[model samples]
Target: MLAHARQLLDGSVPLPAGTARVAAAMLIRRALEELAAEWSGCPEATTRSQLVIAARRLPPTEAERACLAWFALSEACHHHAYRLPPNPVELVRWLSVVGGLPAPHP
Candidate 1:
């Protein structure tokens, strides 16, 4: 998913607002899913809300926690069809927070 997100962000051409929105959503969603799965061993489907709750349990930095909170409430991509595409820079920051999370134990 991150790879696909990267492809969408390649900037080979100007991305449509809808395309950018989907890309941002996909990247963040995948990141949240992974974090949730790592937090809980269930490994089944999980919602963004659930992921955010799970994230709070981890020993995350304040910025990471805030980023997760933003992901939980931000509607940047939720209404892509109705609203403007999210800022690429902000999306990248969210992705960075995800990337910064500690790896799961072996």
Candidate 2:
């Protein structure tokens, strides 16, 4: 997903910049949502609750940053008539942070 997001933003995917931005945000949001669910041990939890639950197990400082990014990603995923898609810089930042998450324990 991260690779795809980068491709979309970098023009490899051939999407309009704004569309690519939104698409990348959606992909990254899904990845983060899944990670939060796994960390929280509640696959069935709603996206809104997943982060809060996961934060309990995450490091104190990192959790706050993750939550802020998650919210921004969520908003970016939605189409707002009045607002434009998210900036590529924010998506790139999120990709790095999500990429840095520890691999799931077996």
Candidate 3:
């Protein structure tokens, strides 16, 4: 998902900015899902909304929390807007911080 977001933003896929925002939002949500399962131990979360609420129960860093908040808003409304598309570079940085979380111990 992160790679696809990068590809879309890098012009390899030639998609619109809003499309890239959707992909970026998805990547962030993917990170949240991982956090909800691994950090929060709520593997039953099946939807982004559930993951979002579950993530709040964990102790994410300030940056991670901010990224999650941005992701929620983007996923909820950015895809339908014509302006204020998310910046790919910022999205990449956010993914690097949030999506690059380490695996949990066995």
Candidate 4:
């Protein structure tokens, strides 16, 4: 599974970004499912929290940064048009770093 994750990071799979996101989500979901089965008494919330943290650690590449910027702007516009709360600007900054738009500050 780790190998598969690494492959995904390598960007050699030639899939669309949305497709890749779905695949990545599925992989994480499966791991959570397995972990839940293995640790019968563990809270699902804990497992989900840990998964989110781990997923956040998977830094994006330069190409991904462009995608994220476009995605964020599109989402913001959509929400604004509908009178929904705007997405956090922190998300844009975080995605910028993760997508390799810029190096994270020390």
CA lDDT of every candidate: 0.60, 0.82, 0.58, 0.40
Task: Write the residue-wise lDDT of candidate 1 on 27-83 in tens digits.
Answer: 776665666676655576455555565556666574356445356425665664566
Query: Ten residues in a row with the worst lDDT in model 2?
Result: 97-106
Q: Can you tell me which runs of candidate 3 are displaced by over 4 Å?
A: 45-83
Q: Rank the candidates by lDDT, best first.
A: 2, 1, 3, 4
The candidate that wins on TM-score is: 2
Number of the top-ranking candidate, with lDDT as the measure: 2
Per-residue CA lDDT of model 3 for 1-106, tens digit only, reads: 6676567657787667777666666767565555546544557755454445544654556435644655654554445545666666666666666546554445
| Ranked by TM-score, top first | 2, 1, 3, 4
Q: Which of the two candidates, 1 or 2, achieves a greater TM-score against the reference? A: 2
Q: Per-residue lDDT tens digits of candidate 2, residues 12-96? A: 9987888888999988888887788788788898876877887787887667767887888988888779998898788899888
TM-score, one value per model? 0.67, 0.91, 0.58, 0.36
Q: Provide the lowest-lDDT 10-residue window in model 1.
A: 64-73
Error of 3 at 75 (Å): 5.9
- Could you give candidate 4's per-residue lDDT for residues 1-68 as a string of tens digits? 43453344346777765454444434433433343333333345554443344334434444344334
Model 4: residue 28 alpha-carbon error in angstroms:
1.0
**Model 2, 50: alpha-carbon shift in Å?**
1.8
Native-to-model Cα distance after best TM-score fit, residue 37 in candidate 4, in Å: 0.4
Q: Model 2 RMSD to the real structure? A: 1.3
TM-score of 1: 0.67
